[model samples]
Target: MRPGLFASPRPDNLGLHDGLLAPAPSTPNGVSSQATDSKHFVAPLPMPTDCCVSAMEKLHGIIESLGHAEIISADDGYLHAEFHTPLLGFVDDVEIVCNEQEGVCHVRSVSRMGHSDLGKNRQRVEDIRKRLEGWGYCC
Candidate 1:
């Protein structure tokens, strides 16, 4: 499994061609329809446990500093974070998606209500990214 390449979920049904703009098995019309959806996608596996843990620690620190953010859920594969954002004047639930194939993480701050309003939740994401870079997680 590469970063974004996926195998056909059902090769027998031409399902793979249905999702491809240039159909693998071209039609008589000689013009393939643009496919916009895929039935399946394979993601790269995570790095070694030690490497993953090290990166996670770096991410943890960034979230903690943001607002004592508590890790709602975390595993070697992914991490879900929740914390108060002074900038937004509210608590936000952020999802940090990681790809072990390359040991890379993508953090997206999702809106969550918790005794405050949404302000600069995006900024918190930036801070987290910078810290990850500092911690050597490929940013």
Candidate 2:
């Protein structure tokens, strides 16, 4: 398939709101640490023992190391990235927000267009979790 043949326009609600990332869509194409439903819920990443800024920096580095990933915006305690599938260039938006008081990083990953992602979003988040583990960070 041609790259980005199925790419959809980016969603307007793509950032944190009132200190929480936007909820995952009702469809199965997304997953969120903040979601109340089991189908869309994933445990948040535990913040690194260091500071929020340091954790965000490490998270940013890990995302950059993943080929085909693009950093959209990054702040002191928040990050947003887009990961493109190699074959179709399907875009998946991943957002992370560091809650220092809670000591966890809220995450959400969703396909830009699709009814089902076949677990892609969940897998991507798991992959990130593993990479963070390699950095001596644990859940």
Candidate 3:
């Protein structure tokens, strides 16, 4: 087994800062809907007109439904989850920042290590986006 297979350092650049999730790093190993640049830009999730709690529950449900996902922290409008790569156990941190007033949810996903992740972070967010849409949410 690879050393540190079960260990992942806590991400230093996570959480809601001023009602927004942190931007994705310049590296390809990260992606964020809030990112201004095209390289890291993803469309934010669109929330239904329901209450914030209901929207959060839907978001939480989608994340939890992902087989490899483990929610680390959550609250009324924020959530952090870790997704593990099946083979090597690489960890990716995903955070969602819900802006109830705007009816959108910002997202960020980043690998804990490596200079590049072959677009996995971007793909992961896209996958979640699709799943949310399938469940009657929009983006």
Candidate 4:
């Protein structure tokens, strides 16, 4: 498949609102730490002993190590990245917000265009979590 052949335009409802990332959509193609429904909910990543900025930096490194990931925007405690599948090149948006007070990093991952992702979003997040754990950070 051609790259981005199935990619949809970036959604307007991304980023943190009122100190929380946007909720996951009511579809199986998305997953979010802030989601209320079990089907779309994933636990936030536990912050390390270092500062939130450090955690974000570490997270940035992890994302960078993953091929086909493009950093869209990164702020002090927030990051947005797009991941392309190896075969079809389908795009998936990933957003992360560091909550210093809560000692966690909230994350959201959603397919750009699809009714179901066959659990790709969740698996991606889990893969990230595992990588973070390798750096001595726990979820």
The positional error of residue 11 in candidate 1, measured at the CA in angstroms, is: 36
How many clashing pairs does model 3 include? 0
C-alpha positional error of residue 110 in candidate 3 after TM-score superposition, expressed in Å = 0.8
TM-scores for all candidates: the values are 0.50, 0.92, 0.88, 0.91
Over 4 Å off, model 2: 1-3, 48-50
Off by over 4 Å in 1: 1-50, 85-89, 113-119
Question: Per-residue lDDT tens digits of candidate 2, residues 2-71?
Answer: 3476676778899877878888998999999999999999999878545788778889999999878989
RMSD of each: 15.4, 2.6, 2.9, 2.5
For candidate 1, give the lDDT: 0.44
Task: Indicate the worst ten consecutive residues by lDDT in candidate 4.
Answer: 1-10
lDDT of each: 0.44, 0.87, 0.81, 0.87
Expressed as tens digits, the lDDT of each residue in 3-47 for candidate 3 is 247547777778877767877877778988888999888888878
- Whichever of 1 and 3 has more lDDT, that candidate is 3
Query: What pairs collide in candidate 2?
Result: none
Sorting all predicted structures by lDDT, with the top scorer first, yields 2, 4, 3, 1
Clashing pairs in 4: none
List of clashing residue pairs for candidate 3: none
Least accurate stretch of 10 residues (summed lDDT) in model 3?
Answer: 1-10
